[model samples]
Target: MNNIELLKSSMINIVENKYSFKNNGLFQTDIPNLDFYFSSEPTEFNAIIYEPSLCIILQGSKAVGFGEELYSYDYSKYLLSSTHVPAKVKILEASEEVPYASLRIKFELEDIYDVIKNIDTNKLAMNVKSEKGLFFDDLTEKLYEPVSRLIKLIDKTKEEMDYLAPLIIKEILFILINDKSGYFLNKFAMEGTVSNKIVHAITEIKENFNEKLNVKELARLIDMSESSLYQNFKTITSMSPIQFQKKIRLEEAKLMLLNQNVEASEVAFAVGYESPSQFSREYSRMFGMSPKAHAIYLREEVS
Candidate 1:
């Protein structure tokens, strides 16, 4: 078999062995930045936070929607989220015989900055139109080999991991910076771009999601007009700022209710919803169930 085929086989083996118990969810790895995912069957669309990360599917397909754009990635392609964006994702292909399995590596903004700073500026500039924060591209041998090496390190000693993981991660970053899609991400490191400004607003929203957001102030902070901010932000994230905040608030409320068994009203307030009725209405709309019912369902699933 070819190297790509071999890498896929190895990735499937490692994930199936390590994540045998988790059939349709994320499984954390010992590596700080890496996470493994599996799905035994197709899943309905669900809201999720897409952090700055890269993901490669070894066996199945996934569809991620942000605003009007729907991105599909399978074994032949990989997904990249250059910045944090709230999106609805679904497992499009999986079965008992060929389960969906993938690996994701989360990287910090600083990592991208480091890559851009060290690389030649002339080489970085291209005429590519700025796309959304997310991208999908064909898989390449250069990315596959380093990812395979990183997964192999799961069996190594802590001393070896301590010494090797960072080197591998840096290598992956180098590959990403040199890749064609790197242009989508490279704009983030450039200071005066509209994409960079939107990212700034996103960071602020994430940091203070629970507080009431002032759109005028946010636009001023980013040195853009209110209309421009809304248009460009939605273009990149597929959601208006208020919509983004509400998505995060409801997501956080779901976690709090699921983990702590807190009253829905309390959870709603904690996540910045002033009215319990409004929270329940919006929560039901997003998650397809009232908070109480969703929490109970989640509890039953875990039990």
Candidate 2:
């Protein structure tokens, strides 16, 4: 069969199996580190923070903004995020006729290291320097097979699943390590590398997102010069330190607005925005509506 036909078939089977489980915003497989989503409608402007994961869209398209760069991925392309960076994501297209279906496999640095130790290092290409948190790469049939097998394993009994998922997981990583962007993944997994240091800064920002930060202090914390820190931070996150902080702040404010009846001013302060007007301005720009209006619209949709 042709590649398109193969992908369609695999997607159909996967969605059928996904529906067998309890329906939610996201679904995790019986195996650890495997999850999929069947989003019936497009998502709104929101930032999701997650660790290194591979995301493949079987149908429809998504637009993800990391720092300043926006990336769109469809069936022909896949997204690989090597670090946990805050970013906005909106599902640009989806419907009952063509629902948005995606599979995300989370990879642990330890797991990648273990696989690297066993494999021949000479097979990997030279490391490539990249600044964007999101990467879009062409998908191949060989990459599809391992993912398809993992989805198929969802139907197996617990005993069969326990035995087979790890092998499949390792195979998936092997395919990724040999792909065009494999070096980025490889560098991320290595200790004491520039990529590793940047990963550390990302972790600090995520853990202390609510706190006011100083660039020099953060640079010292990560043991890098101010210039080196600024360059590396912008490279990996696609935004400067202040910009990353604002993204996190805005995302937090959005959650508060949706989940609570708190005043906009209170939400702004809570998210580290000292000026409510500044928060409102940034919120309107990001969501294309004012904070109060956006909240009301969201509430009306739910009601």
Candidate 3:
């Protein structure tokens, strides 16, 4: 078989053996940096917080929407996100005969930095405008080989995994830095760059999800004017600062409602909404159900 086909075969084998559940869910891998996702059929778009990671599709198509753009990738393609961005995702292709299977591999700033440190930074462009933090690119054999071995490492002896996993991961990072889409990620990793500054703002909004957010203050903190901050932040995250904060709040509220035996009203307040009605209205708009109803639905889904 060809390299691409061989890689897919290996991915399908690992996924079927480790994450064969009929329902849609994330299956944790032996490595902390990796996870497998399975979906049996098409699903509605659901809000998600995507960390810095690379998502490789093994067998089906998926759609990830952020702000006004929707990115779709299948077995021949992969998605990369350089920052923690909130997005909406849906499994667009799957069934009993062919389930949607994919892998999510986490990456850290340190990984990117380590790979770029020895490279000549002068060759990297600095004037590139920040677009959406994530991009879809065609998968290459250069990337897939390492991924294949990484999957095989999961079933290896503990000593083999501990010694080989990091090396494989570093190779993956090296491949990413040389990818056509690496320009955006490289810009993100460079110290004191505009993209890095905007990342700081994104981090602040996420960490202070429950606190009052002032765009003016955030701009000042990032040492940029409000207009510059607004443009770059939207360019990178695809949402206004306030919109991002609201998403963070509602996402946190959803987790609390689903995991804790708390009332919807209490969740609203805990997530920084002063008026429960306002919270309910916004929550329904985003999730398509009342918080209480959604919580119940999730419970029934698992049970």
Candidate 4:
């Protein structure tokens, strides 16, 4: 078999042999905030909103839609999200013979900042954009080796986990920073950096998504000019500030509708829309179906 096929086979073997699948569709490990998965069926369309994280797929393929942009990657690629963004992801390919397996590592900004303190700043690239939050890169053998090793650690005893997991995690981050796209990762660690400012703005919007927000006020809050905020907000989030807020609102609405059976009008008002008609218009545009219809579709799919 070719290299890609070999990598796929090895990854599937490691996951199935070393880890036990949990009810939540992930394999548990001793390491906190780290999960693994091996799947053989296409995943349903779902939204993922999370902090800085890395996802490496060892086999099969998945598609992620961020705003109007769609990214598809397989065994040959990996994905990184530096900020919380509303995205719809679906596994496009998997099978019992060639299951789709992935490793997901979540980390706090402070941990990364602590690690950056000892590293030389000169190692990072000079030019980095604040608004470029998601990235995908080609996978190499070097990168795959450590992932394989990390999976092996799952079989070790608790004592071994304490001594070995931290080292493995550090090494993984080191590899990421040393790669060609390391500049983006580096920017995430720098305080008061442009990317950090954008992150701050994102935090504000997330916390106050239901509140009426104006461009001028948000720009002032982040110490940026309104025009600059508009430009950079689009750059970092791939959407304008209003668009970003609407995306967050719609995502939350989807969750509420699915879990709480919230009426469409109540959901609209709860998420900051003063006009139900306008909310429905935007919601349908983003999700492809009206809120009521989407809710029904989700319920049927889950049932």
- The numbered model that scores best in lDDT is 3
RMSD of candidate 4 to the truth, in angstroms, is 3.6
Error of 2 at 295 (Å): 3.4
lDDT tens digits, residues 39-143, model 1?
889899988988999888888898998887787888998888888888889999988888888889898877887777888766765643345788888899889
- Which regions of candidate 3 deviate over 4 angstroms? 21-23
Candidate 2 residue lDDT tens string, 214-293: 88998898788889888988888767788877777777788889889988999988888789998899999877899999
Off by over 4 Å in 1: 126-130
RMSD (Å) of each candidate, 1 decimal? 1.7, 3.5, 1.5, 3.6
Clashes of each: 0, 1, 0, 2
User: Once model 3 is optimally superposed onto the true structure by TM-score, how far is the C-alpha of residue 301 displaced, in angstroms?
Assistant: 2.2
* Model 2 segments more than 4 A misplaced: 20-32, 39-51, 63-72, 86-93, 127-130, 157-167, 299-303
Candidate 3 weakest lDDT stretch, 10 residues: 120-129
lDDT of each: 0.85, 0.79, 0.86, 0.77
- Tens digits of per-residue lDDT for model 3 on 1-303? 898898889768866876674657788877878888888888999899899998998887989998888888899988998998889999999998888888888988778888889776666655757677887889988999999999887787878888888888888988877777667778888877788888889989999989999999999998999999999998888888999999999999988987899999999999999999999999999999999999998888767
Candidate ranking under lDDT, highest first, comes to: 3, 1, 2, 4
Steric clash count of candidate 2: 1
Q: For candidate 4, lDDT tens digit of each residue in 1-303?
A: 866567656766766776632222566578775687666788877766756887888667899987788889987888877777667788899876666777787766666666667677687786745656888999877777777677777777878877887777777777877786577877866777777777888889989999987888888887888888888778877788887888789888888888886799999999999999999999898788999999998788566
